[model samples]
Target: MPKLISQINQLQQLGLNAKEGVVYQPSRGFFKIVYQGLILPNLPAPLRYFNYISLVGQPRIPLCYNAHTITTSAIDTATVLVSNSQHSVGHLKTYSIRRQCQFDSEQYKFDKTDLIEWKIPKIHLQRLDLEMGCNLTIHISENISNNSALQWGVSDYWSTLCLCEGEVFYKGQKYQVEGLGRFRHARALHLPFLSLCFYTCQIINLNETTQLAFSQIRNQWNIILCSRLDIQEFGKPVESFTEDVNLHIHRVYPKVRTPNGKEMYLPREFSWQCKKNGKIIFELYAQSRGDYKFGLAAGYVGSFQYQLSWNEQCLQGEGGYCEYIDCRPLRWQEKNQDEKILDKLMLLQPCLYKK
Candidate 1:
């Protein structure tokens, strides 16, 4: 399909200007889409397919489509590892998540961690500078494993929608993107867009890091800074995988837009958290979306033992900057707020872990 045909088909399916997606070409041989980071339930092995289409006068274009691949990253030989990771709301939980991940390809090992972070029941406007529009649906439990000894089978799906543009670093692959990027999570918000999309998620490897960011849009000026390092060691696929991470609200603010002359402006307000495992390594908070001159960071030496500057700007409005730190303690103005309530809830009813 040519770009024109693809656009036509996409508009027909997704609606005109309703949502847009920018694409990326995977780094040659290591090209593959990692669907776990998406906000859907149950990702397939053959995440997506790109068919090169060209007609008489037109050049080659990839007709991107979604499909389910029938290949496991590893064989169905399994063992188990029990993990006890901390929830963000300050809870020490112990449970056994099936060991289905193959951390080591050569050793023929399928490992599983305790849990994954669930971003839910949360106010997206709780964090400043970090603004997002995420949709969440409740998943009722179902029985998958027969013999009903424990009386539970299918757990809930914790997924959310994310539209972001920035440095998409994962599995040693870097995707510096311009334009609004839409991600449908595999096995978690895991679906595909009719539009040509590329995924280079880094979470496939536990040792790897995947960070998607948006440059700060200041005084109507925009820019971006993107650099990625890819790694392809541990992205193997599986049959059915699920996680139970708790969503906690750190702060919430009602969004407001101020009118500047003829232009109306909505300044972002936010701060929130959800934990994976036993530690609170991730928190949602905001930085100052302040007024700066020139938009070009000129002759500036900065902290973090390195320099910082913007290299490109996306024409789309999805790009913005300023890192949001975890504002847990400061986020609460109400006195006597304790993070240990979640602990009591878990202890009072441990069956909350089951369906």
Candidate 2:
């Protein structure tokens, strides 16, 4: 048990002002609420977002949405890659959009339909697809309290874990879902274009009242940039693992191509351990479930099963959500003039080339 701080309260203040995220310059921060393992009885698999939204790239010029003027020149972007399979490798439907965003103390809305609301101990998210005439809602039923606020390079991070219940309405049917949820809000003083080399995050619930969350990043030279592990238990203080921890990704799958042709590899298996004075405090090994959603701008989302040992207690076969983003440079090949001409020709005569 240690001193705890409410990170959400501080984000509330920052979200209200336009000066914090800098409307004109490049900003590197975001507010994200994710509900993973949302079991839907009506659907084949669960529902979740493939990639979280952030202020990563250069903001588009000031724009208007729904006849509403956006004072903040910065734009918010996110991609929702929903799938019917729970594994990491599969066909995915991407809902990637850039829209004018509005943020206040209570709600953060992108465009007119997608919104992340803060109700305090009960977070509500609403995503409406106007074209498809579908709606989604996820309600988190716990308080968002963090063990600590961490700093790495020029970025500051605040994360919390909780339980969630969700529902989806599509094609005149209602689907109910529930699972573990997480809230993360991060801020970077300057643009983070070159701040990170690669990032990995995994979250799993060991039991009804206990959960394990791990995040690690490396620099361009394959050095540990920053890493953290959070052990959250109900009715107790959150614990952190930062020092003297040996975290490693034991194996990685071959490079896979996204639907859009971006190529990146993913972890097949990974393990980590925390040692103090030749005694093991915690250790975990996880293997991917082979289910995933790619085509998310050099990142992928999926599920994993893990075995963990903490304080002499052993747990196995626990499943969770995992995300890996490889920011390292990918091999780039310029298309020759003949290949470029062929691409244009195919576009002009798609029917002739239909297989």
Candidate 3:
């Protein structure tokens, strides 16, 4: 028993054993943090240092945001504004989110110039109560090229009282979508090779007063750059946690052919867990709910809706998870290697698939 305990200790030291308060950096840029049940005063900033990277033959892509704002009005309405500028080409894009009351619930409208447009209809279960949870439906349209558009739909049941659940659909393919909505953030990255991939994160929300956020970043050689988490409480500051996590894949779905007939394998189910001080404190088991394929560079990439079960603080709940995957080109050693790099990145984290 003592030998087993010692081995566990060694794994913890190697950043394999998950624990709250222990910061783990597997390589130069990957950072991971785990917070058991602690309520942090504030939330930490997301990937502020490594904001942009320049590749050998590609343009310098900006990974950091220059400014963002959130405003709440008296009529139970809110607005979010975010802007980012590309350093090399001086290209700038701005995103706007407007949320307002609609009937007994709310509606969130998202717009981005030359990129995307979507509307999320949210229905609260209880009248005048935001804690009971809400129902959401999302219909999105993204312009990929002058001749084509990408369309998808997602339905979500979000609750602070119990578990959350939903489904995602694209071209008649449906995937499960379930997860906690207590805390989430939008992340955007521009790769000279792959263009831009945006990540929408949703995790389990344990309680009313506590929330956590984090990100895992990687590079071209499939090296992890960062995996960081931030814990925050209502009306308080934020505390940061870091650690490495082991991802176990239980199943892989059959390959689906894209519009161009390129085959892509999507993982149907997987599990992830983290430990703190040698005891398991957090874990997630998930399966794909729906998926879609889109063109990128010379290849195509995929995204999915996930059904998630999360365990933390001796408490377990079902929730939603969304992820993106990079696939291969039709030919070998294709000129655009960014998609290959994205495919290799699935090994970095269980729930996260970005660099």
Residue-level lDDT of model 1, residues 16-73, one tens digit each, is: 1212221112111221222222211111111110000000010011111101111222
| All models, RMSD in angstroms | 24.7, 14.2, 19.1
Q: Which stretches of candidate 3 lie over 4 Å from their true place?
A: 1-202, 212-214, 257-264, 277-279, 291-312, 327-355
Predicted candidate 2 versus true structure: per-residue lDDT over 1-355, tens digit per residue: 1111222233223212212331111222442222212222112344332223333322221100100112232233333333333433322222223445555666655566556666555556565652222233444334344523323323344455555565554444555655445555544442322434466777766666666778776543445555778787754556877767776656667777654344556778888787778888888888877766653334666766778888788887634677777644453111222454676678884345556
Residue by residue across 137-215, what tens digits does model 3's lDDT show?
A: 3221121011111111010111111122343222233334343233111111221232122222224344555554433
Give the TM-score of each candidate: 0.18, 0.62, 0.35
Best by lDDT: 2
Q: List where candidate 2 sits over 4 angstroms from the true fold.
A: 1-105, 129-156, 168-175, 189-192, 258-262, 295-297, 329-355
Rank by lDDT, highest first. Answer: 2, 3, 1
RMSD to native, candidate 3: 19.1
Kindly state the number of residue pairs that clash in model 2: 6
Q: After aligning candidate 2 to the native by TM-score, how far in Å is the CA of 12 from where it should be? A: 25
Runs of candidate 1 exceeding 4 Å displacement: 1-269, 288-355
The window of 10 residues in a row where model 2 has the poorest summed lDDT is 60-69
Candidate lDDT (C-alpha), each? 0.20, 0.49, 0.28
Residue 322 CA displacement from its true place in model 3, Å: 1.9
